[model samples]
Target: MKKLVVTLALSLLGATAFAQPLSPEAKTRTLETLQQAIARRAFVPGVDFSKLPDALEKRRAELDKAEDMRAFSNTVNQVLRDFGISHIRLFTPAAAQQRRTGQAIGFGLGMAPAPDGLAVSTLAPGSHAAGVGLAIGDVITEVEGKPAGNNPTSVDQDGRETSLITVKRKADGAQKHVMLLRKPYSTIRKPTLTWPAPGVARFTLPSFTNGYSQPEVDALFAEVAKAKAKALIVDLRNNGGGLVNNSAHLLSLLLPPGTPTGCSVTRQMVAEYKEKTGKESSDPIEVAKWKGPDRKTTLRKLPPYQGKVVVLINRGSASASEIVSSVLREERKSLVIGQPSAGAVLTSIFAPLPTGFEVQLPLSDYITPKGVRLEKNPIKPDVEVANALPAKEEASDPCVLAALKALTK
Candidate 1:
């Protein structure tokens, strides 16, 4: 409980790992200093500076013996996950950043850039590019004939690619010929919201590609009220997650005050949170781990949106996006429709590095207070719906149909 309340500090850098070569001694010194900071909240002063060289001998046991990058990554990730702090992360140095200063682009599937440009990194095979002619590393060069790059003046130091780019597949090479521009991607889908039914609000979350925080949540609740909504149908068809806590916050909106949405468990004990006000509503036995004024708990004065809510989700709903669907069903009686959500609930913590970047590591396991783990297994819809049965399902989704039936009844 002393550890679970650790909140992630603002990300000082992105989750891209840097590639720095460190001697064994340097590694041990760095690890010891970092651990001391975590333990004491300050650095140990006046220590023997030369001892770091000796520590490298131990470091060689791990690095020198590591079979490959994959094995090393797995070992590091598992070790990080053991730490209950959701904010702790580690990024190894990599060649991805140093080798390419230009933005890597991809034109695959029907997926194109939005108002925000697409920084293509990886390409899925079964995309529009495969059929219309594109390669794996191909960067989109143009969209309906526009140079879509946003290459701005280098940030005084690095020639980071800041452009709306479309890379065409080179006639012979694996890399796509790229075109840079200043205009927004023409194919990018801005949210076009509409109410599909009197009680159903159909807004394309296009993707959970953006971080949804408290303010975004406030805006969502406000929208529901503005629409005079009694029941909400969140369309998470293609949405991927942005922030895990944001999703937890979304669950908080639906949940009554004092209900435990999720818990983070650490090394030796169950993690605890404090509201600075309310107490956990669960049984007394389950409440003992909670302590301290600074203890982590729910946010004070949860927004009072107790009206019936329905979440329409699919595989694209992942990470924090799944938090809503999972918590609603687990914490409240809210109906879930559409399809199963992507079962990736663990939060990614990005730890800052010497360079202006951070390493993203899966730091901790997330679960509902009731103790339901949602890692490999996603939350099953109260009712399952398949894409094949379009007409008879009436709502084009079995889950939606079931939710509507539940709400109206």
Candidate 2:
């Protein structure tokens, strides 16, 4: 019975195993996981990721073969926004590109939650925002048609008290409309890989939601194999983490055979144990754990890379990303770099409820191979690097530079 709980607990820990492309059907199922969890009160404040994308897919096939993918994806964006979860998001290739270059539409204004309205923290001078005389202190009361408070976590520019923001310009104030954005900037998606340092070999696995998760990861490994790279670098910089099976395959790629990636409880075990005494244990019962330890590779029977590795992390690197980084740091002769990671490395699994939905919950806690747990207190980098975000434009990245320096030694 203990085994079952243990297994259930490990389900979340194993999410960093691998990344695979999600089929339309699989995508739908994944979102269902969130909805069901909300229904069962497993993952609170959860919203369904299934509805938007599925609807768009159908619209493309029927409504307009000439449909603009960008527009369709925008719809998906708005839908995700409705959920109001900080981590609940969707990113696409076009959006990703736009974000990187910062060139789409607005004069350059970024929003944060203020006491009452949205905060205009980042402003690109001489852009549309500045041209129209929108000052940083100006509060944003509304965006399009929705209430800003749909996401209760928003603030205005003046730092005043406001919610359900629907701010209109003075001219439009009596018109019941707010002309918040005179110049609209383009939106972009997130980066798939975070290259820590120039000389380091490994890369961070930020999320499996990227369509190329499986293929790109395989290619990365293959590249490492071909290069015969010795010093590796994996940077889970601000990665929120995603999915279960993908995490498993990711770990499988690097771990020695039978390394016990994680343990979890599944239905079959639940049924078997329940049958034994017709009673279900309330507490977590240990179940089967993933044991993928040492093994020989097909290529010249070579062993997995046992060379030095350094993982770069921060408070944002949560869930599965933390697990992989922590495991390698614990078992191998590796170094952790940067500030402390998010430290969410417990085993979590998504439970599929009967109502076509699933709920993801943490099952059990895992100690490092050395038996040290990485929960609230994340792994501290052996050599801490100062926090640099939106990455400052220098000749190169300092974190990568640090990794290179470490590897050279």
Estimate the TM-score of every prediction: 0.50, 0.49
lDDT of 1 by residue, 211-329 (tens): 33466556767787676777776655545555455555555556665666665443222223335334433322233234211112255343656567777676556655566566676
| Runs of candidate 1 exceeding 4 Å displacement | 1-104, 108-193, 203-213, 237-239, 268-303, 355-357, 388-406
> Whose lDDT is greatest here?
2
Candidate 1: residue 389 lDDT (0-100): 19
Q: Can you give the lDDT of residue 46 in candidate 2?
A: 19
Each model's lDDT:
0.44, 0.46
The parts of candidate 2 lying over 4 Å away from their true place are 1-152, 155-199, 265-303, 346-360, 363-367, 388-395
Over 124-220, each residue of candidate 2 has an lDDT whose tens digit, in order, gives 5444554555443344656545555423223222222222235433223332333434334432222243334443474645453333256667777
Error of 1 at 57 (Å): 15
TM-score for candidate 2: 0.49
